[model samples]
Target: MQIKVSTKYLKTSSKKMQPIVSLIKGKKVEEAINQLKFLPKKGGRFLLKSLESGVANARHNFNLPSQDLIVKEVLIGEGPMLKRWTPKALGSATPFRKRTSHLTIILETKPGIEIKKEIVKKEKVEELPIVEEVKKETKVVKEEKLKKPEEPEISKRVFDVRRVASGRHKQNLDRLRRKEKGGIIGRIFRRKAGDK
Candidate 1:
């Protein structure tokens, strides 16, 4: 196993890279490369470059192919601070402390041993037991109804059946017909011209 570091001091770099570095440590070379390709961190890119260099070193110095590269460990540590000054209110100045980091990557290769071609075992696509997805009828999630002006009480009034049944909507017409007149009770549920 050989450990190598890209930067002696990362004093101005982001500390956010520690978690990602920890995630890839001890992972396979291929997986680490893929993860570092799109990871969204400033130090991650630099750390990836260093890790790749270590991997390359294993390949070239040890006379081994890429498949033999394995990340043994990764180390992250705090680096020297870069002091900065910022303008503050009331014509004063504020001293700002900028943080940096240092990263070390270690890799190892198996020696004097032959490794078979990596047979990528495909994850058995679990045949979902042919789940006959019962075609769910189209569903409409109902939203809240708008607040409308309250109708007059008209508690004692009785409504005529002939006035309500301007049947544009069949369901509304059937509902009005089923609700026969019961004096005040009937008037409370009367249909207007816009009911349909």
Candidate 2:
């Protein structure tokens, strides 16, 4: 069985991904993953994610072992270009494209291998007893809740009104203190050299 996985619109150019893809094509899944883990390129990370996704799909969905899987194909294609402009000297703008790439990896088991799917059989469940237990538990919970007293609801507006009233009173007191210290002209004339 062949498993294919794709990553779309990676923020890199196809040219940047070419070397990484070429290095892993036709290699075993384990070898490709190891090489990708140590590669020092940004594109390597993107390709590695695609390869791992393909390998995981094969192992989990098809019950194929990673050791038996090989990288059959690696494809990198150009994606949409993000157009941007930079300021130029002569009141003109220099336009550029931020390139993107799409990567796809195909993994297949080695030749002479056949996939066998395992079937799981579910046993019959006794649901009537479970339903009766849930009903009894719910009744006990309702009785416990009925025995508790309800809490009184506090009004948030009362606290908010008090806070606002205290703030205004403080502001008025500050204004009166400034007036008692005489007007701005009196305060400035009487001010010490070190005082504002």
Candidate 3:
């Protein structure tokens, strides 16, 4: 399996990045990372970033091990150029082009070995015990509510329809409805209109 990663429009010249690309073009993933780690060049840092991104792509997306992967291709292409003008002698401005590089690294598995397939184990859900506990808790709560002193008939009738709703949901609905009764701006307009 082959995986490719590219970084575009890097703020470095293609010439500067090409040598680093060549240094690890055909090396194994591990060896390439080690080589780039110790290198003193700034280009090496960018190349290493792209290489590690490719390795992670292979491992997570393709289930390939880092040890079995090789740096199949390292292609450096010229990206967009930034144009500026530098003042030269005799009040004349010379055009300057700040070059950018697009670095692409391709990785593939070595031949004769199957890429390992990741096994996705479904989590074991023990629903019976949880359901049993919930039922017991509900029963206890219901008994406690029944043992409390009886409330006024009017208040019971008013709240009978909302008995099943949890308190948090009731509070949220109240907050939303209260906000809908015209916020600060609307209240200000209402005051001006004498419709308080």
**What is the C-alpha lDDT profile of model 1 across 1-196, one tens digit per residue?**
4535455676445457667878787877888888888988777678778877776766655555657777788877788888999999999999988888877777766555553444568897766553334322222222223446699786754375444456434546566666664456655666775542
| Per-model RMSD to reference | 20.1, 5.5, 14.1
Q: What is candidate 3's lDDT per residue for 29-145, written digit by digit as tens?
A: 999999999999999888888888988888888777799999999999999999999999999999999999898888988998786677889999776545788889999999998
Better of 1 and 3 by lDDT: 3
Candidate with top TM-score is 2
Candidate 2, position 87, lDDT: 98
Give lDDT for model 3: 0.86
Q: Rank by lDDT, highest first.
A: 2, 3, 1
TM-score of every model? Answer: 0.52, 0.67, 0.59
Off by over 4 Å in 2: 128-196
- RMSD of model 1 against the true structure: 20.1
Model 3: which ten-residue window has the lowest total lDDT? 155-164
Please list the residue runs of candidate 3 whose C-alpha ends up more than 4 Å from where it truly belongs after superposition. 118-196
lDDT score, candidate 2: 0.87
- Give me candidate 2's TM-score against the actual structure: 0.67
Residues 1-196, candidate 2: write the lDDT tens digits: 8888989999999999898888999999999999999999999988888888887788888899899999999888999999999999989999999999888888889999999888889999867545788889999999998897889998767554425865755645767888887877886686577775
Cα lDDT of all candidates, in order?
A: 0.68, 0.87, 0.86
- Between prediction 1 and prediction 2, the one with superior TM-score is 2
Q: How many Å off is the CA of 156 in candidate 3?
A: 43
